[model samples]
Target: MSAPGNPGAPGLAGNSGSPSDRAAQGRAARKRVPRSAHAGWVPSLDRPDPVAVLERQGRDRLPELLPIRYGRMSASPFAFLRGAAAVMATDLAARPHTGLTVQLCGDAHLLNFGLYASPERALLFDLNDFDETFPGPFEWDVKRLAASVVVAARENGHSETKAHRAAVEATAAYRTSMRRLSRLGELAVWYERLDADTLLPLVRSTRHRRRAQSTLTRARRRTSLQALGKLTEVVDGRRRIIQDPPLLEPAGVPDMAALRKIFSDYRSTLSEERRLLLDRYRFVDAARKVVGVGSVGTRCFIVLLAGRDADDPLFLQIKEARKSVLEEHLPSGPYIHPGHRVVAGQRLLQAASDIFLGWMSGPQGRAYYWRQLRDMKGSAEVAGMSPTELTTYARLCGTALARAHARSGDRIAIAAYLGGGDTFDHAIAEFARSYAVQTTTDHTTLGAAIAAGVVTAAPEV
Candidate 1:
């Protein structure tokens, strides 16, 4: 591993690197990787089969749940894009990069940015998913976020021109935010975060304000108590998770002993104080839960625990973590356990993370990470937004993404490369438009595979 860069040293941003020198380096990078190079999406001639990649991922997951994964991906182009992060990673390998590295969200789609509660119990807006996070070129994340705007806008019945405009505005916001962060002190940039007070004022439209308020309300209501009441029942004399077919089901008695050992191992990953606090809660039950379009087949377990009494409840979700999709295209790190890699990446990138977040190895040597099941977590409903609202949402996501990148990447170099212009924004907009088409084609191909009986796809719930 390489030594960390000193933010105040020579050759660094916010330091002795003169404005002219930085801008000249930025301009020089354009010559090496011109803006036009990012105009469209062309699958490399030797690109691997998309279906084959999906099948390979499924090998480590539950065999019975593979059909559900396929069905979820086949639902729409947007859904397919979510499940095909590995496919995008392969395609992005062929693109021109500025060699500026950041701890990437790897799958920085619009839906991935959301509102979640900080340890202080205050709501903060930030990147909430890190399953595919890795250190890589900053622009890869921007490309993914920009394309998601276009794909989601299309799914919401917007015109292509409007969708393209939203994507452009998002990239513009990212550029502007990067420049803003570049001028701040390193400590200031590190401390900057988008909390509720800082965020509500950014929404100028009444529609967006109402939507944001409603989302926050819903998130607060999604506590462990609510989950306990809705997902469990007292059967005979013991409390157990209610069965719900393919989505949720009990882990059964045979696995409980081993699961208890796994849970104990996870507690050891926490600090002494956190582990002591956790000891107050006794494990009640655990059940497998199918979650998200892309992760429907992965082993996700929601464990129920009680502190003091039955009413005092806590829920921890343990999700299997495989190697990040970016690992294939980017340089590998020292970490071998993918779960530990996720926990480290998340802690480094976010302003604050879940207090219970930790990692452990499970039966059969699978890596898994655990965190609170719900901590005022909420997302925007893209299907129900106007074009103006969509654009505003896009800009907010861009801003949050920029803040994350600034905390971990060479912000001065990235800001200078982006410059105070719309050239890079327009290039990303064009790439979003082109990639949206490619995603649709890939979704169609998967649907054809299901129809041909080569892959079975269960009906979506």
Candidate 2:
């Protein structure tokens, strides 16, 4: 498809190079691409068949995609629809122009943004989901965010016009905010963030005002001491994970013989100083904990660490690392190891990450990254948020998303492309509306599949 404004020419939003340079880059990137290059990739909007696209990808990766399958079992028809990324990916592949790319949160839905305490115990708001995060077209993130607004609005029984307005508002915030960042110096943009207090004034309505107040209240309650109280329990005179069935299960301790060997290699992944620092904490126990709808099945494990005194405790989560969904669709780049990718991406995107954030490649070649399990972690209650509260929350997500993008790319060029206009706002609204319809249809197909016994739900206890 031709770029948004130009006839017979594709647009790259931030391309400031000469026409020849831009043409050469585009040609080089697109040339010699395998048909299968687009095989697992979603189709462009000019050739829209979201259903077919989803089916193609689903058939290829059902086994890998199974972990994100749990919450659908008891969800509403619409909620079930909201959780289908495999299906959504195909629908998204079919959509239109403006190929400006960024390191996207990949799954930038409303619920993914929230409050998390930094290493210094300062609670801040930021993007909390990264399963689908990687470099790809910026429009993909916008489309996902906008469509989520529609789904959320529909669930709250709002009119399509109201939902559309919220999506438009969100896109406008992104465009306007990106332009604001583009004008700032690099250091200014890097240090910029929407801390909770700074964000409170942005809540426009009474409902949002109330919700923001409640959110702050909850965040204040989530101290490290509170996390220890909630996530730990005494088991036979030893502190252990309290079993909660599917949501929170006791993973049990790792095999002593296997762990002694594995940890030697694990120590090699740390810096010499960090390895020495870790030597202070004795490994007590470890267990698997299922977390989030999209990340449920991946091998997520928690390691319990303690000092000489059991009261001095630390919890760490070591989740499995895999290729990003964006990697399958975007142009290839430098081959950084996946563990390095996770650590670097987290450090770049988050104002600060867990102090323990580091990667280790096991003897079996499995890559895992370790981080504080819930270092004062909390999220905005999307289901509990009113429509106005959701809108305010969406704006927070958009603002944080723009800050993350500004870190690795030129904001000035991005600002020029957006040009303080409603073009992006209108375009994304169209995409969101269309994609939300597609999500509904795909959700139905998944329900049908479950009914047909094609995919089994994890047994409900």
Candidate 3:
């Protein structure tokens, strides 16, 4: 709660500046990029076609999956926002920025942060998705997260005032946490994490704690044995993944052999100990499994493996990793493999990560990263949340994001820039409201395209 380490840590030798000095510098930045300037949102006249961008990102994806992606995205404004990261990237590029870089959760929507098992098997809350992770202006992530709160609140039938309050609380928490963390030693800042036990005190009521407890219990049950029981059955004395139509089906017979070869290639990327641990399990089967609104079209697979006995199982997901949506607008250093970019960015941003996390090159040189299918993972159901619950959740997310940024960003400078005030929070809340309208407009445009037969989308089941 207090800054993690010694507040009186020595300042740079022969320098009059200290943490307060850095804070003052941040305060000065308000003149250059006025806080209020961020409150406005408008699509540029030359903004790229949203539908066209969706099609372009899908060019290399399985043709059969495109309609499914479009279908999932068309379900709601929030759903559409998830799949429209590319569209948002173009718009954010046209906005004024403070030029502060941090490893970003390129698609930092409400659903993307969740509880996941760390290497030590502790349940920790942090950013859980990183396909779009990139190094860019820190506020871009904040803006996306804040807008998500507003969009989600509106979808949940909350009033505009409630939505604005949620966004404001989140931005305020982000600013305050950053200011607190700025006083910590770098190592102390890096070591902070939001473990389940550590988070319980933040819950204001017995009911909320019970709900969190229930979620944790449910997550703990989501193990490999449980997945095997649900997704596989003994067929002719062999274990095989069940076929569930377009959602889950076996890959081509020819691709199975290629999968085995790449699975081995993936193993080489792990540590010696993990490779030994992994060797106990042999590849059993793999099936193309559609996942998430934005990732539906990508090459995502749930792989099954057997350990010393058939009863001992492991499930790993091999998901295609592509260049981040932010890459085109804000150039960063080149990455030879998109999978490495995702893996590296994830490691840099997450407080703790999966022990099995690794990347490999699949057939046709497509890049993919592999991790446990579902190890203590759960997300908040924003639609069912009360205003107070939503605000608390937003604050938690904001605090987690600040910790993530502090690990890789210039925390002192950023904290200084934010200062100890409500100015940035108020600006971000206004931005959230304006952007929520813009998201609605974009969602409507996609719906119109589908209605006009200009774009193809399957019916949501």
The model with the greatest lDDT is 1
What is the lDDT of every predicted structure here? 0.85, 0.63, 0.84
TM-score of each: 0.93, 0.82, 0.93
RMSD of 1: 3.9
Clashing pairs in 3: 23-416, 26-416, 26-417
Which residue pairs in model 2 clash with each other?
A: 36-39, 43-93, 44-94, 45-94, 45-95, 251-287, 251-288
Clashing pairs in 1: none
Q: Taking the tens digit of each residue's C-alpha lDDT, what string does model 1 give over 1-461?
A: 11122121111123337766755676676775676677778777877788887887788778899899898899999989998998888788766576667888899998899888988988888999999988887889999999999999998899999999999999999999999998988899989889865777778878678878888888878788888898899998787889998899888675677689898889999999999999999999998899887787788989999999988889999999998987866666647899998998888789999999999999889899999998888888887688888999999999999999988887877888898889999999999999999888888989999999988999676
Residue 154, model 3: lDDT of 93
Off by over 4 Å in 2: 1-74, 77-82, 205-207, 246-277, 459-461
Instruction: Indicate the TM-score of model 2.
Output: 0.82
Cα TM-score of candidate 1: 0.93
How many clashes in candidate 1? 0
Instruction: Write down the RMSD of all candidates, one decimal each.
Output: 3.9, 6.1, 5.6
Q: How does candidate 2 score on lDDT?
A: 0.63
Clashes of each: 0, 7, 3
